[model samples]
Target: MNALKNEADNKKTIAIIQTTRIGDLLQTSHAVKLLKENHPEYRVVLVARKKFATPIMFLLEKVFDKVVTIEHKTAMFGADNVREALSKLKKQLKEINEQNIDVSINLAFSKSATYLHSLIESSNKVGPYFNDLHERVITDRWSQYLYSTVMRGDLNPFNLVDLFSSIIGTTKKLTHLSNKDYSSEKKTNLLIHPFASNEKKMWKANRWVEVIYQTLKKNENVKVYICGSNQDQKSADEILNSELIRPFKDRVNLWIGLDLKELYSKVDSSFLFVGHDSMIGNLLSFKNIKTLTISLGTVRPHETTPYALDNYNLAPKTECAPCFPKDECTEFKCHNDVPYNITHQCIGQLLNNNKINIEELNSSCSSLSLSRVKLYHSDMLDNGDLYIRESLHKDQDAKEVMRNFYHIAWTSIFTEINTSMDIPSFNIQTKAQLSSQSKGIETLYELSEFGKKYSRYIIEEISKNTPSLEEIRKFSAKLDEIDRLSDLVSTSYPLLAPVIDFAKVAKNNLQGNNLVKLSEAAFYTYNEISLMCSVLYEFFEKCSLINKSKPEARENI
Candidate 1:
């Protein structure tokens, strides 16, 4: 014992980053525990997310020395918003660097997390090497290796927990239900977490009502408890209203919005959890419980199912399964496939066996679907097609593509008009106003006018029209003009003069397009023109350049 203690005392400062969600923190805690058990004195710092920080603190006592929490909001829209998030992230990296960490492990699959790893001055950094804008050099195939090691040998990379565990070291130790120190609490037969991190991932409200109804009918004694955050309370209320559940409403208790530790305590007490494919489902896997995860096509049964425990994923195989981080289908065909009947039957099977069949847990059963929108070199792609490649040519082909894209964009604008046309049924505006507004004048329209009256015609026209070859040529010419402008700004501006010189030298060294060089010259000439215009404007503002508020040319009048 003394020898083991002595070896443990020699451990170093290690940082573990899992800045995702509540379930991610719980899943990675196993690795933290493993490290702590092996090296008790190694100072472990957990960089957790703000929402789950409070819940994570309870487990920090023995496994980690410090809990550094970062607040990050997911599912944000717009490039400007994303850029602001990156700025906040840069601030976080500066703060983390103060700790002088020895080794950093990033478990979260975020480009921002990868960027953070690159910014922090750590002795050794390990994480998956994906295409990151921040860390252009540091290479680590940790996620791949992790998947190769921790999962069952025959199956492909599917289970996320096993994939995450693979990054640390290999361990076949069966992950049991979290040992919740619930000596003061009572035990429960079942826990039902119906809510998910996002609205789209949720199974239909009526389907949940039916599942609870069928489960209670099968076993009267089974204690049914609803678990979720505060956001889930409304769904729980709807479930109680179902005719099948009205009699059992009192027995079907609601335990939503409990802090992380409290939620874990509840999870520890329950025998099984009936929920969707969510972070909670993933966390339950580590706790060794029979979980019936209802996956509604946002992800695959194989790639993101519950990790390290006996669980059954109940997502029906569809043409649009595993939509991934983002769904491309405008109709959301993925969610439509998972019906109420399928969910009820899966729960029935789980109730019959009372345990998951490990053999059936393989990846082959998953409906694997990849996202159509992929990020590449700060550019966007549609279903892996490089629609917006780096501007290489000053030719007609590029111009034609741009023009066609603009024409196609009008379809979206027209859809907005079609939606607002129904607003008149609400008695919000009169027919005369709608007709007058429908004339398609925007810049001169009254602020009080409804959008349907003023903009619908123009929107419709844009939707109807297709791009011509000439239009494509004009679009490319505009881009070329912008490039020329940038070159001009670089040449004439004192602050940017060095940049222009460097670009010129680099272009010459690499033998880049001569047309680009000519464009640069034209841009510089335009900058000179702009400067002359500015001087003339200032001159005109003076009394000397004007004849009593009139220009010199109009002085005769």
Candidate 2:
């Protein structure tokens, strides 16, 4: 037992910790199934919160060999029952530790999850865990990438499912939910989950009224089913009270009473699920039910769109969209941005065969309506990971343009999996933004070079016959100044936020403990950052110069 303590390579058991909500668990399930399929020898264990895990234990039981749950509410018994809670937590951790876990991955980046991770005995760890000094540390590259880019902003290009797959050290295989035959069914039931966990992500009931009315009016044999939690009774009343829905009252079914498992079982392929960015949509996606997600404030569609083929997503073109939760919002102009007509059209098309009429929708919809929203159809890549393609690219914005580059950059930089990533065609405004942002890239390069210089100095000093600790500390302090200066560059050019964010994570999760080893690790990180700068600079320059009469500019970047 003593010799095998740190033998991570010998063990085949891996523990995945996902203590978040239902949607996150669904996404994790999608990624892990691929890992299980490819390496059936590995025994997968799960660590999740009791509250979240209880809802979907029926599904979790099939995927994982052992499921250990943390009783969060019990653990927070305040001053009254703290000892009892502590005893339970210790028992839970001891149970997990005895499983002989080789790898313990914390996909849920909550503070509680990090605390739990520190106690679990794993030969190797991935994702965030508090070290002995009580400082949060994430050693793996993919987890570091996730920590840096996700939740920061619209800068993240890859979907959550894709990122999870990357972190699990396995690519998602091209195994989608099996195709279900819905043609035999005469009536097509459309499941609409209009409410989200947060208010910012959902549309008002009145707007949904227009959508339901139009959908029932234009399409025959189509029923609209509404589902939400019991807490959403008041909001559901608002939607149900609409006069527009009066004629189609017979077709609209509200099944708020059904638990998650019941809802999952009841909704089949014949039912098309349309809603805001919510768990109902994500849960249904596992069964390969078609989903139409309308992402609003604080929801980045690129990251959280339903995981499957032929699904759809709609998000506003509002500049402050996918805004931070802390931001002020008197009126959700982003909600108003998606007109009912566009949504009705989308529902009709997908109802037919789970395909959006890109050309027809673009040619038919009013220019004013087109100007308000951006439409994307979700599809998976060769490796079975999901991606969304803009169906209507007539008004592709600058932010979308940069997202494309970073999609290529991040995938290549982290995974070393180079894509045949093409350069996006730019509009006048995008070209202007690109030109200005390139200068920020220059500043980034300068800062990165200085970082490399300091790292080198630290390494050189540590290599001396009689190394001076004070001299080494001075060089390390200079590197800290350089890292601080990098924030300024991102401030001036928000487009370079991902670049700065990634570098910060890379430096924080540096390899080695001693000054000699640590200094060399810092040098390699800065060196990599410098290389990333070169790649991004080349992309920016190529974009600006693409207008020239050169065929080479048209080639894959």
Candidate 3:
């Protein structure tokens, strides 16, 4: 299952193990491009699932010097006996092992991938891999950030590509698209993919039918390409055969059951792309083609939106949106939360190569209608990473303001970068919320000081000739209480929970061989949180200087 393109002539190889779905494979490409660009002499290899990598061979061939794929289903199920299967797997792995991989990075976040990471032969390993205790351990800061913030909840501020590039040790956070692909040479074709990985993540065919019917009617020069896989043939037919779409038969192209490379060609011929939260949106991202993603069900628009500039995302403001897969929901209300009218409006603007403006959207959409969904555009963050910036919201609310504070705290603590301060105008309610945050921050900061004090006590006692175990235990118990109290503070504020959780995880994964070294590591852990709290407290102090005005509530970031 090891598919080698042009061989690397005795160059050091860097293997990227990303054994996930098609979307993740596409996400990995962004980082691979940066790695190769930074170290062109180093041969970059990709370790992906056989099924996911094969379909995108046309794309992967251009990015990776060599692709090592895992065909576990064939090796396990195709074999006649257990011994034969074992032989088959070992044969595939032996080829991978012989590559003498200089660095093996695991972008795939799974137990199986973690186990596989341990098997790869490399002088250095990054991302998560199994330790001697068979427990998953991540040592790199970026991977640790991914484990703490991203793997836990939707509050993570960085895009997946940004995290991947950081994990690969790349210096710049560059966008993948060049101006050459986004030129006016493209035809007036629009690519629309309505299918998702599961029913929970997409809308019904009738909803897309209405959007397509309106789009074709408004733009007579544009043709629509309904894009999907072979499995979506039945669903694609339902949209194409709708009575509303019958009049636009000449303007519509049904692209299904074709090679993935063929789909890339279709993208070249298209001027814009509109789709649900699916792989096609990620695939279309390689090009700068304007995209409008209607994220429904469990999709966190901020996390999964295409990592290209000028991309737009629309998700329901529904409280239950971006729910977990395990949550039982027969209602599927998030789908209905986004009306098709706004979708068509955004497409109309993007198709004409018009930048979406707040006034432009306000001219056509109602306030109540707009309130149900939020429109965001992919823009560069202060650290050069990609993030969803609110395009239509008019002001920063309490939650948005808190997110900005956390952004500063995380940016200050994890990286050496300092973020530009963004002081949002506050309403009376938001001012009250800020007052609450001030209290919460003070409490949390005090608790972090206690953590540092306890760890310092342990370090001090350990330095003595006759260290009392009871005193060490007493301080340790006090430190444990401080952590529990910090967790309780998050329940009141809710916004500060992620950092506290991350601090806990870091303490649990503290490195060192003995108590002295371990206690120092623990002290560093608390010191970082203490620094984060200090940074946040400075922001609140800065906010105190912003002129507070009483006015009608407005939305913005």
Per-residue accuracy of model 3 over 6-28 as CA lDDT, tens digit each? 25557778889999998889889
Worst 10 residues of 2 by lDDT: 548-557
Please list the C-alpha lDDT of all candidates, in the order they appear.
Answer: 0.47, 0.78, 0.78
TM-score of each: 0.52, 0.92, 0.91
In candidate 3, list every pair of residues with a backbone clash.
Answer: 393-555, 394-555, 394-556, 395-555, 395-556
In candidate 2 the C-alpha lDDT for residue 497 amounts to 90
Candidate 2 lDDT at 125 equals 83
- How would you encode candidate 2's per-residue C-alpha lDDT over 1-557 as one tens digit per residue? 11112333553888999999878987888777767776666788998888888998888888788888777667667326778777777787888888888888889999989988888898788889999889899887778888888856677878887788788877444465444543434338888888887778888888888898888998878988899889888888778778888877888888876788898889876888888855777787767777788888888888888876667888898878989889989898898888889998988888875677777888778989987888887765554556677767754567787777777777777767766445677688877877777667777777777777778878888788998889988887888888888988889999889889888888887879687788788888877777777787777667663232311111111
Model 3 residue 36 lDDT score? 69
lDDT at position 519, candidate 3: 83
Q: Which stretches of candidate 1 lie over 4 Å from their true place?
A: 1-9, 36-42, 60-62, 72-95, 98-100, 128-135, 143-158, 169-188, 267-270, 329-342, 345-353, 356-557
| Model 1 collision count | 10
Per residue, candidate 1 scores C-alpha lDDT tens digits across 174-237 of: 3332323222222246688887766566766786787788777766667788887787778888
**Which has the higher lDDT value, candidate number 1 or candidate number 3?**
3
Error of 3 at 134 (Å): 1.7
Q: Give Cα distance to truth, residue 206, candidate 1, Å.
A: 0.8
Model 2 quality (TM-score):
0.92
